[model samples]
Target: MRLEPDVILANRLADAAGEVIRPYFRQLTSVEAKPDRSPVTAADTAAEEVMRRILKQDRPADGVIGEELGFERLGAGRIWVLDPIDGTRAFIAGRPIFGTLIALVVDGQPVLGVIDQPISGERWIGQIGSWPSTTLNGRRVQVRPCRALAEAHLATTSPMLFSRSGHAAFARIARASRDTILGGDCHNYAMLASGQLDLVMEEGLKVHDWAALVPVVAGAGGVMTDWRGQPLRLGAMGAVLAAGDARVHAEALERI
Candidate 1:
């Protein structure tokens, strides 16, 4: 139907988060560790706070699942998933590759997604509906085709995130692909959607991590799913894969 309002609100949320995060980029001096030992800076918490406040005022009936902050309105059916900074390590290292991920999931399916890199002033928006497409800064983009997995360029945030068994599984895909690059968190998916990269496979992602990626990748003519080749949903496993070409995706799945 008409998703214009939601889309506008999503953009507003990204804009607000970016404003909050920009000030702390390279100036951030302190960081705290979560039980998982992941870094959380004031920037992350502040960015999520601003987005959450805006959502509460603009779409109070909707739910929110944020990385820095916890869940809100879990049963609201229409949820906004937020990852203030998908690449905290990259962000802490003064890298501009980190992104703020915002997603609109309705009934467990992600219908809208935005990957915004404030430092680079780049945004990728994707929507699924009667007409499905992805745009980067208002320009439509599509994934490039790859004839075979041997010719595909692969990327993953890091192999360290995977368990022993998972690492072995990903090693198979890495060996089969043309080349594999490390350290790109959510940016790799954005690159895949924009035809810069071919595939991104990683493990140990949460719902907020992969939810927004589904629409962004799919709308750009790519396929994003769990390691088993199943469509990603609300509660899917953390192991995720995104491939620009379905043929390459299928081939990678077989290897995984």
Candidate 2:
């Protein structure tokens, strides 16, 4: 497989972030609450800083949308989205599931993405077009099929993030699926991409939260959509679903 400039740079971006985030996990680091009451930490800011500095030097003309720093030069044809520590709560608690997310969106679509777990040194790389599908480390990976909801292994971060209107839809899926686990954050999506998870549904996501996930899941032969079963974009309404099998994704969409 040929490596594009975005893919090569995205790998380095994740590495730079990991270097900054590793020293803070499980250690006494400053944790602060955002205006919205979400928890953030020095690690989150520091990691994003590292990534942003690299992007400025390497992809200077490209735009950036970062979780900690907000948007910059965002109208450019190619934009980089960064979520340095996707599961900040998990990171704070020393859960290895937390990941650094980086995505390159060009012409409004994500063409390249990386999900990196700094502690474990595990990276999932995904890209658009017709070549390599997806990979964990250096090996190929793909999502598994589950035709029926009764056979699905569903996962989510939490029901607490579900919107009031989305609750019944979520309940229906939870009742139908064979198993469900809460609080995997982006790890659940990575697992779904690797065929270990059959389905993942979540609400209340920002673009930075789910942008990288689109290619990761799709390149692995899965489907990711909004609650209405449409493709994801930068300004989506936050309700999202990812499924390994095409049939199951359609079935879940109908139920939602």
Backbone Cα, N, C clashes tallied per candidate:
0, 0
lDDT tens digits, residue span 45-160, model 2: 98999899999998889999999999999789889999999998999888999999999888788877789999998999887664347899978999987879889999999898
Q: What lDDT does candidate 2 reach at residue 233? A: 79
Runs of candidate 1 exceeding 4 Å displacement? 130-132
lDDT by residue for model 1 (1-256), tens:
5678988998999999999999998998898999999999999999999999999999989999999889988888899999999999999999999999999999989999999999999999998763348999989998999989999999998899999999998999999899999998999999999999999999999999988888899989899989889988888989998999999999999988
RMSD of candidate 2 to the true fold? 1.4
Q: lDDT per prediction?
A: 0.92, 0.89
In the predicted model 2, the residue pairs found to clash are none
Number of the top candidate by TM-score? Answer: 1
